[model samples]
Structure formats: structure tokens, C-alpha cells
Target: MENMRSENHRGAAMEGVKLASEAAANTNRRALRDIKNILGAPHQPQAVSKRGLQEKPAAAGAKSQPSAVGHRPVTRKFAAILQQTQPANAPLAPIGSERQKRNADTAFNAPSDMECSKASDDDLDEMMTNELKEIDMEDTEEEEEEMPDIDSCDVGNSLAVVEYVDEIYSFYRRTEELSCVSPTYMAHQSDINEKMRGILIDWLIEVHYKLELLGETLFLTVNIIDRYLARENVARKKLQLVGVTAMLLACKYEEVSVPVVEDLILICDRAYSREDILDMERTIVDRLEFNMSVPTPYCFMRRFLKAAGSDKKLELLSFFLIELSLVDYKMLKFQPSMLAAAAIYTAQCTLNGCVSWSKCCELHTKYSEEQLMDCSRMMVELHRGAARGKLTGVHRKYSTFKYGCAAKSEPAAFLLDARRA
Candidate 1:
């Protein structure tokens, strides 16, 4: 009776253990479901391993046989958790099964951590290359969208863009350096006095107008004549030929549509044949050593006018003053830049009724009021003399409406005669 009671007690203990195991598994399943919902993953029912929990029917189908003691089936999730927490020496799976044997072989033959890392780095490089290609494609599309269309643009009416004025300044500086004239230069020709020079220049101006050559061409013609006369002595008869040839060469140098040699011959009333003009042109070029890059007061006048913020009237007066200086041989003693600065200052004092040079003028021209005192006085005296003299080409040109009649107007007597010796 004691032995039978012991068997019933063991059976009851086994049933209680089975019920506890089922309850724990149910709790784990619920926890896993909660985790899946929190992670936004679809819930998947896990397979519960029943390796040791196979049920057998009792004799005559009375009841199910109990599983062996201490053997509780676990769900896949629970098995994973227990495996992670198990000691290194603990056996995870049965060694006798084919699946476990294959797993052991895979673990032993697998690549080392270093080898796996190298393979992962290669994969990462490939992925980065693909990502960079995608980024470059996006950048190219944005660049295409941002580009301006040339055909639809109105470049002429567009607001002025900043220019590299420094380059222009540099070019002018180089020209000045090359065109430097000796102040002590004196022409040797007895026939070519200052008065004769003035007459020739006046005729050149008329010719310049008749031909409609650029102002630059007239200035250059005078420069070539002066430079040549300084070095060469010529007969009074050939002086007119020299002037005509110089104009032809200057037109070639500066004019976009240069007058033909025949036109120049015609303008000279056939005084110089085409051959005579061509021969003199070659002689003048040879004597000057091909140094035709003579700087003119007009070059500096443009810069000074820009600096002074000159209007059309102020510019016209300044140009008139400069042209008057062209007839005076004494004005050649001053450099082109100084003549330009003095001309503008005199024009300002005369036309605008200003008493003296402004600080802005000094800042731009780099010439103080005192520095220009003598030069300005000389310009004023030249203007007064041109008014009384017979060479009226420049005077007639400036008296026209085209020059805003700048010559018809005169400066205040006090201003014109100021500091005159």
C-alpha cells in the first residue's frame, strides 16, 4: 500500500510540473507578441520544440502518459534566450543529431573575424561608390537647371558689369613708358618754326575732319610728326609731305576704316604722289625705330575726365584746351599725363566757374592744386593766344554745336589771368 501511494504522489508531482511549464511558456509568448507590436513588426507564432514532450495513450485509452521528469519543452524564443545566458561550457544542442553535427562543422570551418571584416569593407566601398554616383547625378541635374540660356538673353541692355580697369591702367602705363620724350629736344629745321608747325597742324586738323578719321588718329599723327622732327631735318617744301604721310600712317595705326593712299594724295591736291607718301611713311617709321606707340594727352584726358565725373560741356572745354595746346610747341615740354590733368583743372575752373581744383580731382589725378598751378596758367594763356591767332581749325571745330560750342565761351578774367607772370 505504501509503494502504491508513492507512485500516485510521483504522478501528481509530474502533473503539477507540466502545468507550471505550460503557464511559463504562455507568458513568454505574450511577452514576445508585445515586443513585436512595439517594434512595428508583424507577429509570427513561434514553433515550440516538443522533442521531449511526446504524448502516449495509457492502456485502454484511459489518459495521456506524462513526460519524463525534468524534461520541459521550450519555445524557439525561450530557447534563444536561454542559449545566450548559458555558460560557455554548457552544451546547447544534442551532439548526436545530424543538424547539430553540421552546425559544429560550419562553426569550426568558418572564416576568422579579420577575413569577415575585410569582406565587409569591400561591400561597404561598393555601396559608397553607388551612393556617390547617385549624388553626382543629382548635382549635374541642378547645374543644368541653373545655367542661363544664351539665345534668350538681352546682353546689350544688361546692367554694366565690373571691368578690369587695372588692365587698362597697365596698358596706358606701358605706353607712357615707351613714349617718353626728352624735354631738351629741339628740332634742327630752320624752316619748321613753331608758327609753321602750327599752320601744318591746323591743316592736319582740317584734313582729319574731312576724312572723318578718329580723334586718336589726329593725336597720333601729331605725335609722329613731332617725334620725327626732333630727330630729322627736312626742307619746308617736304614738311607738308611729311605731315601728309604721317597722317596716312596714323590712320593705318588707329583707324578702323583707314583712308586709301589715293584719297590722301587727292586731299593733298596731288601735292604728294602715292609713291612720295609711301616713301616718306617708310622713312619716318625707320627714323623712329618703329616706335609709333606714342602716348597722347587725349589718352590721359579720358582717364582724368572719368575721374572728374565730367559732363559733356566740361569734356568739350577740356578737349578744346588740349587742342589749343597742340598748336603750341612749348607745351611739348610737359608729359602727356600732366598736360591732361592741367587741361581738366583749367576746364573745371573756367566752365563750371569753380574757384580752384577740388579734392576729388587731386585724389584721382594725383596732382595737387599747387602742382597744376603753372601748367593750368600755361593752358589758359594758350587759349587766349589761340583766340587772337589766325590758326582757327581747332577754334572753328570747338565753336560748332558738335563740340557744344565750348570755344565760344570763355572763363572768368580773374580765373584765366590768375597767377600769370
Candidate 2:
């Protein structure tokens, strides 16, 4: 009889253990559901694992099974944690047991942890995108605001031509296409070549300086020579005559006090007489159809200088670089406006010791530094050789104290580095 009583007591203890385990699993399922709701995830029923509890006798079956069985190990982990907070009457959980408990707790919390992490990642990405957009918008607005209104200051000056300035430049830019000569036109000339052309220009520049003529007169003279030569061939003997006659015509068109034909004769060391210059002048006017109103780089230079808000130093330096380009036949490939813009840009870089293209310059010039680069590079190259070469007329002119010795300034070497890079 005593043996039967002991077996019943053991069975009762096993039944109590099963009931306690089931109660703990139910508590964990409820806790998990509450946590999912808090994290804003859709409520999902806890699923049973493959190692689920088996059926028991009908008497045991009267007791309710937990809605979730996977949480039984997790419930034990929680009990271990809770018992640690209680008074020190209970023995401390073994280190190995504590590790297992933590592992089970982590397994139970993994799904919600991942869901929470994914949601946090999405929020962070959205925040970053919005911040970037705001920064871009701010940058665009700053660029627009920073672009200067250069014309507004000139409104009070009549010579500034604030009313018709934009229209006039638009006209010049449009007509410049007609004024451009082929850089390859030298290939078609029989008696004259590129070297001879450079020599003639170098000589003419010296004459233009000696006469105290306007800069535009020199430019127009070269224009007349190139355009006339582009259309008609001449003997090598007549090339200097062509140069002087073109200068004479340019003087008449651009100068307030035109130099007399006899004066040009005297300057050429009696090379030709009044009849030779007068005769060549008529032939050129007739050939070019008296289109003396064509725009030159000088026209664009004044405009870009004003756009740059230049001082005397910048102005002199820019002129020096352009005059250097004038001696190079290859520079004919660039348009007048392009040459002007590049000259000023190269001058700015030379004076400032860095590449400095302001927003104001780009807007008025209608060409970026990239567009001006090839021309600017050629200008810088000419600047390097200006002081050493035979065609040093320009270098001598700018080196004078009257022109602020702009030619003495060092060339912008960084631009050459950009080419190699």
C-alpha cells in the first residue's frame, strides 16, 4: 500500500510540472503578441515547431495546451532571469545554464528584432534622401543668387549702352560667324605661308604701336588681311604692301586721327609710295565689299572686361595675352568672342595664381572654362615663348612700364598640368 502511494505522488508531481510549463508558454506568447503590436508589425499567431508536445491520457487532456509550444524553453529563460531579481535566498543560476537561457531568449526575440531593424533601416534611408534633396535645392538657389547682375551698375552711363548693349552683343555674336576665316586657309595660298603671315603680323604690331593707334585698328587690319587673303592670292612681294594697306584701311575705319598715307610710306622706310598704298586700299575695299563694320576680338574684350569687373592690372594682362595670340596663325581657328573670353580667363588665372571663373563671367561670356580651355591653352603657350622668340613685338610692348609690364607676369603653368592629366 505504501509503494502505491509513492507512485501516485510521483505522477502528481509530473502533472504539476507539465501544467506549469504550459502556463509559462502561454504567458510568453501573449508577451510576444504585445511586442509585435508595439513595433507596428501585423499580429501573427505563434507557430508550433516540428518538435511539438505529444498527446497524453484523456485525464491529462482535460487540461489546456498552450497556444504556442515553441516558447516553453523561452519561458524557462524568463523564469531564470526573474528569479535573479528576487532575494539571494535562491542559488545563483549556473554560468552554463545562464548561457543557455540567454540563447533561448534570443531565439524567441529574433523575428521581432529583425522586423524592428528593417523598419529602422528604411526610416534612416528615407531621412538621408530627404536631407540630400534639401542640400541640393539649397545649392541651386545659392548659385542663382550668386550670379551677378553686372549690367545694373552701368545703367547710368550712356557709353555703357545699357539699353542696347545686350542686343548689340547679340548682333556681334551672330555676325562673328561671317567674320571667321579658315585656320587652314594658309594651305590654299601660293606665295604666302604661315611663317610669313606671322612675320607680317609681327611687323604690323610694331607699326600699330609706333603710330599710337587704337587696339581695334590693329585687329581690323589683321581681319582685313586674313579675309582678303582667304579669298584672293597675292605674290610674296606684295604681302607687306597688303599688310600696310590693311592697316591704312583699319586706321580710316577705327581711328579718330587717321595716319596719312605718306606717314605709312615713311614708316615702311620708303618701301612703297603713296600710289602703291592708295591702289592696294581700293582693291581691298572693293574685294571685301566695304564690310568694315565686322566685330573684332577688341569688341568682345571691352564687353568681357566689364563683365569681369576688371581693374587696370587685369585689363593690361588680358590685352597682353590676346596680343600674343594675335601673332600665332593657328589662333585664327578661334572666334573673336572666344579669343576675348579666353584671354581674360587666362589672364585672371595668371594674376590670381589659380583657376578662377566666376559665375558672372560664365553667364555673360556664354562659354564655360571647358569651352575656353583649348583657346586658353594656346594663349598660355604663346605667353611662355613671348619673351624669347623673334616675334617678340607683343612681349616688348607689354613689358613697358606704361602698360604696367603685364608681360613680366609668370604664365599659368597649372593649365599645362591639366592637359597632361
Candidate 3:
């Protein structure tokens, strides 16, 4: 009886151990299944259709069919499942079933808020690009307007006129101080000076008659000749050569139709051969160094007339002064301003036929004529003492000019006759 009781107890104990092992295994399997479900299905996957995300069923079974006609729920659910399986950072796939799958994946996995933020950045970039394009267009237009055309060369030519005016003014100022000085101070021997001057005057007159150039140009050439001679103690024999050379230089500088070297030689009555004149021309050009810039009485006359504010009177004064300049080679040594003023004074006297001291004073003040009297007096004496034969050509030219004037006006004829007497 005791043995049978002990066997029963052993069997019961083994049975209890087997039941405990089975129960532990079942508990482990259930815990593992719960963990997998939580991690794999944390959120419901979004449905995708060919068009876009399919609308969710309003209530369970409210849309047993898809919201869109002919749209299948299984297709949308498969797309959503595929999208959910894809990695978040994967690049978009090419267009086709693969691209559709990728698009579905992007839509399902990507947050709505994140896509909205990226859209704002793309809009900002586009706006910036448009603004930069507008700025570039504006810059192009401004560049086109600012660029100058090649046809505007006339504007450059006009600007060059101011340079000429400045050059004339500078020449006037340089000779202003020498206007008052006497010719005796300028010469060592009076008798020889007189004879040489006469020869120079005669040669000048001949050239003037042949050229028929304006009086303004001739006066300028003569002034240059006298001024150069006064400054340099050149020999009396070289005086004619110097005069011709000076005239050539002046003509080249001032005249539009300049005479050639051959023409100048011929005009000098073959006194200078072509070779001789050419040699002299080279020497003068070298000495002057092409600096033939000098003011003429004509230039000063314009300035004085502008200051005086009388165009008609200025015209009359210019005619007489230019004519007188031809007769008196001494005037060449005077400053252009002094000669211009004196000529104007002389004309005024001739016109009114009276001596007005007050008017003379006003004129002197206006042109500094009183200051220039010494130079004017010296110039007058040089011409008065000049030999008569030297001025043969000059006389002929002046006679013709005077005759033309006489034909035009009684006042001019009377003035010419009075001047001869």
C-alpha cells in the first residue's frame, strides 16, 4: 500500500512540470507578437490613386466603393502600402509605375507641413530670379543710352574753337608791355634803319597786291616780321629774306589758301631762288619752332568792339585801322590792342571832324590807348621816315582798295584823300 501511494505522487509532480513549461512558451510568443504589431503598424498608411491620394472612407463601410468613379480601393491601398515601406530620404523615381509608387511613398511618408514649407522656399527663389532679371534689363537700357555715336565729331570741332580764342588772348597779353616803347630805343643807327624799313615796306606792298589777301592777315604777317627784327640784331641784307619768310609763316598759320614756296619766290621778283627760299624757310621754322601763334589787330578790334558795344562804329573803325596798318610798317611793332585802339580813335576823329578830349580819355580807358601811345608814336615815326620807293607795291594795292571804297561811300573817299594829303 505504501509503495503504490509513492508512485502516484511522482506521476502527479511530472505532469505539473510539463503544464508549467507549455504555459511559459505560450506567454513569450504572445508578448513578441504584441511588440511587432506596435512597431510595424504605429500609424495607418495613406491610400494613393493614379490621380492622387484617395479620400478616406467617411465611416467604416461608407465607401465600400472608391470615392472616384472606376477608382479601385485595392489599387490605392497597395500603393499606400508600397509608399509606407520606402525610406523617407529616397530620390523620386522616373515616371511610370515605379514613379507612381515613389510619388505615393513621398506623399504618405512626408509630413504635410514639411511639403508646405518647401513650396514657400521655391516661390521665394523664383521671385528673386525675376527681380534679378529686371535689374539686368534696366542696366542694358542705360548702357545703350550712354554710349556716344561716331557722328558727333562736330561737337568736338566746336569745342576746338575755344582753344583758338585762348591762343589769341595769350598772344595779345604778351606784346602789351612793348606798345609804349619808342623805335629809337629799338635801333642802333637811325639812317640805315629808315632805308632798310623802306625796302621792306615796298616788298610787302608788292606781295600784298599780288596775293589780294585780307588786310587782317597781312597786318599780322608784318607785325611778326617787325617784332622778330626788333628782338634780333639781324643784318640789313637779310631783312628782306626775314620778311618774306615771316610772311610765309604767317600765311601758313592764318590763311586758308596759303601760297607755295615757289609762288613766294616768284612774288619776290626772283630776288630769292627756290633753293634759297627753301633754306630760309627751314631756318625760320627751326627758329620759330612752329610757334607762329600771335594776336592780330583784327582780334583786338573784335574784343574792343564787344567792350564798346557798337557794331556799326566798330565796322567803320576796323576798315580804317586795317587800311592804316598797310601804310605804317611801324604799327607792326606795337601790341595788337594798342594798334586797334589807336585806329579806332583815328576813325572817330575822322568821322566827327573834331577833337573830343573827353571822348579820347574814355577810349583810352576802354583800350589802354594812353599806355600804348609810346609804341604807337614809335610805329608812326618808322612809317613816316620809310623810303617812298620801298612802298611801290603797297601803294598800288592800297590805291585799288581805296578806289573800291571810294565807289562805295563818300566818307570813305574823303578819308582816303585826307590820308594822302
Candidate 4:
């Protein structure tokens, strides 16, 4: 009896374990259904019926006796319930056999995790290449959009762009006269002529500052002085004489009103007599052949700036070029036209902050930026050499004139006299 009771207790424990397992499986099925509903998957009653059918064989096989023998009616009732609940699309397959076949197929065909990772890497490489190709296409489209249409009306006068080349060439030819009055010519002169030249330049610069005529008048006066020197071989003693006369001529030609002979002499610190100035003036008028039609640096500067499409950049360049003129008498020998153009080009390059050769060429299509660079270098070198020791001369003369002669006069009187002078 004890052994039989022990065996019954064991059977009861196994039955309870089986019931618990079935209950857990049912809960897992319900959770899966809820997840499918949340994901918006269509209701798959046929799949559910198939899953139920798969679980049944294990339950039936656990029983040792054939259920058809002892529970025929119960078995029939179970079959009727199954038929009623089963979905129409459920496959007619023996549960254990079909599941085993499916497992075998999955083991043969499915990729391992390592294989999947390599496929992902290949997919990423392909995606990156395609993305790069799209970016290139976008860049091409943007370039096409930014390009100006040749047919547009606003592009006006294609020839204007090319015309500057000829203009630069023509200006170069016009200023060829400068090459004749080289620095060597000035260097070879006697001490007296050199001293007179120095004195003359000093007076010219003084007149320029006093008159407040700015660099334009100063440039014109210097050109007149150089041209006169080019034509006549005046002595050094007469250098002041030539300078005053040339300034008088420039004042009349370039300024609003010409300074009187008395004013010119006074500005000279009484170094020049009225009679001496008058005589020198006559000589200059005759030597120049009374043809005072001299070209100025400003004229060329304007033209070149226009050609380079940089009229807006003129003020700074003009100031620098004018200051540079003060440093070099050799610059006077350069046709006002060439120096002006060259100065403008150099100033533009400096201001725009372009360092490379190609960038400057791109900015101004007319003379190669290389040619402009060479021209600027030559001008600066010539200026530095000629300008040596000249600033002191300029300062001494201006200081004497400004303090000694003009100090007693009214500010307005001084300004007027300076202007006329």
C-alpha cells in the first residue's frame, strides 16, 4: 500500500507539472498576439491554428494508452471542437513531420551572424558611393546655375574687356619719351646742376603743399619740369629759376588761379628775384614751344582703373602713387600715363590681397599681371634709388617757407597765396 501510494503521488506531481507548462505556453501565445496587434499586422487565424496543431502531438504522445480506446466519445468531442475553431487556410500537415522538415530547411539556408555582418559592410560601402555621386551631381548643377548666360543683355560690350590691352599698349608708346631722360642722365650732371635740380624739386614740393593742390598738380608740375629739362640743357644756378617758372606755368595751366610773380619770389624765401623769374619764364615758354599740352598721371590712372573695373579703388592708390612720386625723380621721367597705370595696378593687387600670379591675371585681363608686377618693381626700385637723401631737402625748404615767410600772414591770406602760388 505504501509503494502504491508513493507511485500515485508521483503521477499527480507529473500531471501538475504538465498543466503548468501548458498554462505558460498559452500565456506566451497571448503575448505574441498582443504584440502583433500593436504592430498592425493583419489577423492570422490560420497561423494561430497551425501553431495550436503543432503543440497537440506532444500532449497526445505523453499518454501511454491510445485515447481512441478508452475515451472515444471524448476524443470525438475534441475533434469537433478543433474543426469548429480551425481557420480555413490552415495547412493539412502532420504536426511533428512538417515541423522537423521546416527546421532542417532553416538550418541549411539561413545566414550566420558573421555572414550578415559582412553583407552589411558591403551594403554600407555601396550606399556611401551612391551618396558621393549625388553630391557631385549637386555641385555640377550649382555651377551651371551660377554661370552667366552669354545671351544676357547686361553683359554689354565684350570688346570693352579686350580694348584695355590696346589702351595699355598705346599708353606705353606715348610714355616712351621717358626712357630718354633716364636716371643716368640726371646722375651725370655737374654738381651745380644737381644742386639746382634738388632745390627746384624742393620748391615744387613746397608749392604743392602750400597750395594744397594735392598730388595731381604736383605731378603735372613735375612733368613740366622734366619735359623742359629733356628739351633744354639749363645750368644748375638757374635750377631754382626753372622750378619757379615751371610752377608758375603749372599754376596757370592746372590750378584755379596763377600765383603772382611777387608771391612766387616770396615763396622762394627771396632766393628768386622777380626779374630773374620773369626772364626764366620767357625762356621756358620759348623752349616748350608754348605747347603746354602735357599728359598727367591722373589721366592714365583713371583710364586704367576703368579698364580694370576698379574705379572705386582709386583714392588709396592715387595717394600712394602720389607719395611715391615724391620719392623718385626717375618716376617723373616715366610718362605720367605708364606710372599712373602701373601704380593703379600695384595698389589694386595690394589692396585686394592677392599673392599669386594667376589671381592678379584673373583680376585684370589686359596686360598680364606679370607685366604689371614687373613694371611696378622697376618703378619702385627706381624711386628708392632716386629718392635717397631727398626727404631732408624737401623738409628744409618747406619748413623755411612755412615758418619764415608765411607765418605772419592770415590763415586765409596764406591759403589764398599758397593756392595762387
lDDT top scorer: 2
Per-residue CA lDDT of model 3 for 21-65, tens digit only, reads 788688864432243212222343433235643444456555474
Measured on C-alpha atoms, candidate 3 has an lDDT of 0.56
How far out, in Å, is residue 65 in model 1? 99
Taking every candidate in turn, the Cα RMSD to the unseen true structure, in Å, is 17.4, 16.1, 21.7, 21.3
**Would you estimate the TM-scores of all the predictions?**
0.59, 0.66, 0.46, 0.46
How far residue 282's Cα lies from its native spot in candidate 4, in Å, is 0.7
lDDT of 1 at 416: 52
Give the lDDT of residue 290 in candidate 4: 83
Candidate 3: lDDT of 313? Answer: 46
For model 2, residues 1-421, the per-residue Cα lDDT tens digits are: 9999999999999999788778878886443335432122235466544553333323444777443334243344445565666687865544445656676566655544445677799899999999999999999989777766678988899988898888999999999988899999989999889999999999999899888999999999999999999999988989999999999999889889998988888888899989999999999999999899999999999999988999999999999999888889999999999999999999999999999998788888899989999999889899999988689899999999999999999999999999999
| Model 1: residues with Cα > 4 Å off, grouped in runs | 1-163, 174-177
For model 1, residues 1-421, the per-residue Cα lDDT tens digits are: 9999999999999999788779878886533334432122234466434554333334685666454323443434435666677689964443445665675456445654555687799899999999999999999987655532222333353332225443565577567755655543554566667778889998999888777888888888988888888788877899899998898888888989988888888888889787888889889999999877777877788767876778998899998998888877788877788889999998888876766676656655678888887788888777776667688888888888978999877754555555553
Which of candidates 2 and 3 reaches a greater TM-score? 2
**Per-residue C-alpha lDDT of model 4 across residues 151-173, encoded as one tens digit per residue:** 23324668545435456546655
Task: Judging by TM-score against the true structure, name the best candidate.
Answer: 2
* Residue pair clashes in candidate 2: none
Off by over 4 Å in 2: 1-146
Clashing pairs in 4: 259-420
Winner on lDDT between 1 and 2 is 2
